[model samples]
Target: MKNLCYTLLLLSSISSFAQNDSILNFQDETIYRINILLPGLEIEKDVYKDFSVVGNLGLFPGYYKNNNLFSNSEEGFFFIPFIDLQVRYYTNFNRRIEKGKTIVKNTGNFVALKFTNYFGTATDHRSTESVRIAGMAYDIQRTYWDHWHLNFESGLMANFRC
Candidate 1:
């Protein structure tokens, strides 16, 4: 009886000592974001562990020269409405975690394929009113001040008919 009691006690102690803490893993989450440079609103839905679909809406300045059907030598800038969607894969979660960086809110290095459409006309640009752009880009995004998203991206884009 004493031998069995001692064994149980030792096993309990070992189990207690082994229960320390869980290992740190990657962070992925759905987030609502805003772009500072373009002043836009974005929604990112996490569909998988490292993949997300992001939708953005914004306005950009478009310069137009009055050369259309009902214009006469007038040039001005207008706010062009745009929308885009991106399928982003966060690629460097392990590397960022190993390097002791915060990976909260799906912030990390990513490669994304994007499609953007502009549907606003700067004058009477009926032929150019709607534009389709597709691109593949590599991006790195990091959080600052716990809530700021700072991102940099480089990519190749092509404008074509859709």
Candidate 2:
């Protein structure tokens, strides 16, 4: 009995020695930058001199920062990925005609799609765990001179814990 009691006491003391009674600030700080190149192509071209395809390449870059209430000891790093795509079409036509002059009007349409994924770890001084989130979104717009315009957008999101 005495040996068992002594063993238990020693184990308890060793565990306590691993912990310090110090106050700690828990927060996460992230400084990140990313860039993306998106290309859009019009399957068919009707307004250009030649009935060929029209396309445009777009480049965009941005920075992001986040400060979490928890620090590294109790916090984990994050990994995020995002993408966006856009397309536009433009056309011009004569609205009115006269013997010597003519009036013209402009019309255009646009579409966009976006997606994002966020995954990381969340920790409390002792152990770190993983967290993940995902989402997808899309948008469309159309316009015509002296006519009705239309716009549509939608999104879906999901969150996971492990």
Top candidate on TM-score is 1
Cα lDDT listed for each candidate: 0.80, 0.33
| Regions of candidate 1 where Cα sits further than 4 Å from its true position | 1-24, 65-73, 122-128
Global lDDT of model 2: 0.33
CA error at residue 59 for candidate 1, angstroms: 0.7
lDDT tens per residue, model 1, 38-156: 86899989888778999999987667676767656767667767998999998997786677665777778999999999884644542346888999999988877667888898999
Q: How far is candidate 2 from the true structure (C-alpha RMSD, Å)?
A: 32.6
Q: What is the number of backbone collisions in each predicted candidate, taken in the order shown? A: 0, 6
Q: What is the lDDT of residue 131 in candidate 1?
A: 86
Among these predictions, the greatest lDDT belongs to 1
Clashing pairs in 1: none
Candidate 2 residue spans exceeding 4 A from truth: 1-53, 72-91, 96-162
lDDT of 2 at 84: 32
Scored by lDDT, model 1 comes in at 0.80
